[model samples]
Target: MMDPQIERKLIEIMRVIHESDKPIGARAIADELNNRGYDIGERAVRYHLRILDERGFTSKHGYAGRTLTELGEREMNEALIADRFGFVISRIEEMAFRTSYNPETNEGVVPVNISYFDKDDLETVIEIVSYTAHEGYMISPRVRIIEEDEELFSLPPGKIGIATVCSVAFDGLLLKAGIPVEPAYGGILQIENRKPARFSDLISYSGTSIDPIQIFMSRRTTSVLDVLEKGEGKILANIRQINLSAYERAREIMEKVEKVGLAGYFPPGEVGETLLGAPIETGKFGIAIVGGINGICALEETGIKIKTNPVSTVMEYKTMTEI
Candidate 1:
């Protein structure tokens, strides 16, 4: 659990550090508070600093005073999101979403924001809550197989990924960045290097549906359906031909989507049985021709990312550009 008020205070401090481009001290934060007319004292600021340090949100540097952790920076972005950024990022995540880094030299984290919600579906929320890991469901994806980087963070739903980070910015590999598609949920996520391989060798992930059965039970299907019915986006769903080479195999699904024209087909077989998440089989991506169809949906299902700590999020309210 988190202290909401304290969290807000921490975010305020983090924003100060971010904008300053220099280490910020508790005294500095105190002065800023006073300047902002908060009526808070230095003692209160010290207390807040203690809490931030304990939570790894702030660290004691050698001589630079204190700084926000990778986690802290990501959390602060919620404050940084501009009023209309939601629309801007959505347009981006659609064209291409890639996560690439080398573990031997790079261990930075990319922050991305995804929106997960039960706000409109209490019945669905109830079902998912009481939901246990399915028997054959292995909620675990076999395709999430590039098993080398178990310590890296996985992309969860409702995340706004921040790109361009290095070891100086974080301690692990950076994965994603950008904004979210609206009717979005909240906050951004930090993804670490999910594999030990280099960018040149890592297999590229093409966003496609790997769960056919889940189409009925999962939140993604519902979300896609909602977007389609409301025409929120030109969406494509239940895309099969997963495990496809971004250049070739997935083309089949693309062709079908072309004919169906974003209606999202049911896809052929038992998808999750042999596959799930992003199965990084590594060296085995066979040669296949680029399939078909141009740009299709605004968002493609990557994989199900669960919460590390369920943070309360106010649904799509603004963007980084707007705020």
Candidate 2:
């Protein structure tokens, strides 16, 4: 009702006056607030207007209603131009909100901002497994979970990693085979083959204090595709681009492996394994996608890894130059 809230009400009232094409009287404003579920009395509204006048957010026009001052106009303009998160926190009072138990989608309509996380904040590591092609055997790719203090894993340099995430609480089933399970926000997740978890070449979600080794589970193919399309912010971007090139190279290299039937980094009994009869050609992607806007990011000795990030959505800003 009428408490310190009056000042807040005053700010709102001043803003309404500032934006209106027509001047509004005190009684009309009070009526509007009440209609909008605020229970302020007319007298209280009048008191607020006077305070607003002192603050220069509003001014009196002789016998007419108040109007916003230059300061008020500037503040209003700033509010209009604020970011989505900032606007919700600063201006919005209430909103619709909901959550689900599934992975691919979840949205909260309530007012809040996306927290900027640091490395020290994340202690638990979640990762997905990659199909490692051992020299002697052609085995299907499986998950390899490496926990804290665990011995580091050694794999061939050519494995690729990827992941998908669920917005809701997921059952732990999606995690890699040996990896220790971290406390998830939701429950254990069910990982159908459609939503297979893979290794990520990006590393945006990797926190600073994290173990050098990590992996994560991704959602379905569609979700993974979306994640890949958007790209991880840091290391992943480089890796994804490089991966395209690497795939082309791999096809070339694999073909040579077929032609010469060479083994190891070398070829043809006592000679090099490469089709060109040389060492494997290595291309470099500077960094892995590290997380920022969306998804998780992490880094490894070789390159970076990314989950999902906001890059897929292209937001074209209307530059001042346009007008």
Candidate 3:
């Protein structure tokens, strides 16, 4: 793999060329990159272009600058996605760090998953979310509701927003106690008799730019409603690994959070073992978290047109109300 710095410059240069009406020169590309806050000079731009040319991503027009080749455009598109890879993992860490909800007082901010649905579906939305909470499929029964025309994330016209406590609250709590957590992936976990069975699908956070849950939602793969009713089906879940040595401390924090009305997690599996069928590294144990978006998954199963941004933002615990 090329150095990240060089790769970024190459992608940007390709972008500038692709966006130009005519093949753009190294000087123009360098100037554009500079204006865009990159410290690249024409010499640097030319050096990067040679690399791109070697990769068949750009073609030199002699003194006419360079143009992105067919292969180059495709590579650029994939590179853009690659550049954003692990964004979900980064967001997870960011939100986890931002979380300050103390189990003792429960008065600090907690991470939340945001969803927007038609205002006309308010009655049904409430019913579904409440049912999910009752079924213990949500991170917490608490939720923050925003009516249309409210000052919040761009709520679409005629849409209302529902913010549910995210499972990352567990990560935050454990982290506050000095335990390191590595969120491995978001997956669809099979359930049996209301107990987690195994993961039937997974998307590792390290390889994806988009949240894995959103991808599963797009596929309409969750059987959250089925699991709620029949006690068997798949639901959105995430797997996180922690050092085996911190197991006891992590358990203590888990107990505290559960008492504060935030519930999500399976006890750690044995070191070097798989939990609910997801593999854990040799020196770590894995904890499976019930996804905070399970409630919304139920709503989607019911044929509601909803848009979701899981692990979107954080909100004060006190600001939300129990369903």
Candidate 4:
């Protein structure tokens, strides 16, 4: 059995490798570790990497360094699940602060979710995304299709990737405009007669280890296509709390953002009033927007397999095209 301290170091190394888009050398990994406040040097990183390679958690590439194997990813994700609690909320806040997209100029970056599917399913995937976006159920109509050669990160063999703007981009815009926003929950917002009715289920962002949207998708909990066709079904959504003081500014920012092509259909509710059956606290209102993965949810409902990375990365707004 590995020593507890060794296991911790290995997990940290795997995390760094998992985050990289390409093979990372020991020197680079060591430098990254040091930046993260670890005292490990390149030689030590290389020594530990050998253990990872022997355990099949990583594969070494000549002169390039090492790439995390599938085992590594699974191990890392499952290793310290406790440490990942509330990670989603932290990710949202970080991405919101990192967002620099300027609707006026159509420049800067916005947070996005990435999904992968078999190359053969590309056309079907595009069709589903297009139909969902056209019906106005997605966070935005903007999307970026990544071919093998254009992939920003490694994808499984025979898989293609797509990037959709995350709903958090709205928070980013609001934050950029000096409006502080609080993400409350990710939930299943039930729709009735083509309007959002209430939340059927909710997972607090501060308590869950996995992305709630992913959880819902894995459980096949959404009826996104039904909502599009019959105007009544549960779909993925999230609630954010914003102070009433900045509500008007937030609204104006939303308008400018939508004008530039990202669709956010829901408006903030009155302070202390319920929005979609979720009660608002004093001095703050709730804003519930459809999850960006609604399109993918529709596809999943049809039994098409997809691998998703929610709030995966930020991409330039100008780089994505309208669906």
Candidate 5:
């Protein structure tokens, strides 16, 4: 077995090589280690590199420097896995302490139960439960299956069956039919129904509809009302052909906003064209808007329902020009 100290140094050297933009010399590696508070010399680093090269963990190029080999990469990955396991265990312990119950005093006693299921059965149950919950209803985490002989699929008139046979049947039908069951955000833009028209309406309301696809492509317009009017067919086609690169850029911009502490909800940005039964296409040409809750709210003010999921609250519109 390799000495623990030597193994640790070899791993650290491998990490430095993996993180470098180009092959690095032993002197540079020693300098970097010293900067990180390690008390190692250039000669010692070269000796370690020779040992690593002999073990097929590093490749030495005469003038260029040294680089990690595939074996070295695997070693670094293993180190990362070990670190992640330690992190997870630490967090679990923290949670246990936070939720610890004093049995003698009967304090901090939050009753909870754990359930286990076969992998296949658990996946099926999760799919059904997820679909039901996405429809905006609270559901019980505890699942119960009735035996064939004692099956009771229905409830009394007043007691609603949360996950009844009919509901599951409908979900299955939708799945089999290849109908998309994910919820989406975006709707028709409307201006007047919520309040009485004021003098500012003349300047703020431009009567002309804006194309959401154009706004998405440009990444400049704040509101959906800024794009040039286009036909619905053209808009939908453009939306279908949206450049994925632009979407990534928009996501980065939204992340910067959250990092600055302005956004109320910072969702892991995933840009897509559809949600559940609601397509991102609004009926009016150019007035269509697509985004998360805030975007949905913008269209909802005009009184259009946008389908969303339980996790939708974490998402916010990316079109806002300001915080």
Candidate 6:
């Protein structure tokens, strides 16, 4: 592994070069570092820049300065990942302390609650919580195993439960629960309203039009899902319209919801290809759930219901179950 201080300086130097429009010299880099309160000297910066060049992270121009190579951009991305991991660790420590009592004083008490889950379940919770925090959501999750309880003799031996003290927003919870569902049903809402183009103009508009799943894509980030389009022109038009309409409609919807102060509900299958302006034959434009079973449960808890038929015919199962 590289020395931590050297790695940090290399990352900082790459950041300076990346942010600049043109190649920069060591002196300029040192100045930028100083501005950021790093107190780095020009000589030190030059030495690190040389190391970076040798490592293929940066390349020197004849007299112009040094510029970051593709490798350098990747290194900067790694640095960001490192920073996010550090933040997650710090948050986990804070949550642990907040949930647990002081061993010596027996003070620093929290609400009395109990949870039961197995080791696998705990791992799932941790994975979800870490992902949630990494995505810029605030989550203070507390989890503990229930080792022993005579009052719960009928329960499993190793039961664990988790609770979270978080901001009031269904977005984070939905994302977490949807993590396990396959072909997640979640998609962006495309709204079109000519009257209100911006949030400020929404006050003059009485109603809004929403088109769900105008651009349907899978929730998996591992690989890009192929875009199923009927004809080239149809797909292009759909993309262009949704891209423009979604933003305008979003502003109007938010404004209307705020003014009316009422929740809106839409049943499953209510939104179809006709509403989204896409042909059903394309097989690209239908509402489908992602994240597997856990995702379906999460959606149900949020007051949206779904129906599914088994893809396999070998086994008999319930045709429909309300989430």
Best by TM-score: 4
After TM-score superposition, what is the CA distance of residue 194 in candidate 5 from its true location, in Å? 25
TM-score of 1: 0.25
Instruction: Tell me the TM-score of each prediction against the true structure.
Output: 0.25, 0.26, 0.76, 0.83, 0.28, 0.28
Count clashing residue pairs in model 2.
59
Q: Top lDDT: which candidate number?
A: 4
What's the lDDT for residue 274 in model 2?
20
Count steric clashes of candidate 5.
6
Off by over 4 Å in 4: 1-48, 51-79
lDDT of 1 by residue, 129-179 (tens): 222111111110011111212223222233322111111111011112221
RMSD (Cα, Å) of model 4: 4.5
Tens digits of lDDT, candidate 4, 1-323: 77877887898899778866678889878876764446899999999999999999999899987998898888988996776786678778888987999887788998899898889888899898988987878977779988877524555567789999899899898888899998888889999998888999998787898778779878899999899889999999989999989888888888877777788569778898988888778999888888999999999888888878788778898888887
Off by over 4 Å in 5: 79-323
* Weakest lDDT window of 10 consecutive positions for candidate 4: 148-157
- TM-score, ranked from best to worst: 4, 3, 6, 5, 2, 1
- The models' CA-based lDDT, in order, is 0.30, 0.30, 0.84, 0.85, 0.35, 0.35
Better of 4 and 6 by TM-score: 4
The lDDT of model 4 is 0.85
Q: Model 1, residue 9: what's the lDDT?
A: 67
For model 1, the superposed segments whose C-alpha errors exceed 4 Å read: 79-323
Alpha carbon deviation, residue 30, candidate 4 (Å): 11
What residue pairs clash in candidate 3, if any at all? none
**Per-model C-alpha RMSD:** 19.1, 23.2, 8.7, 4.5, 24.1, 22.8
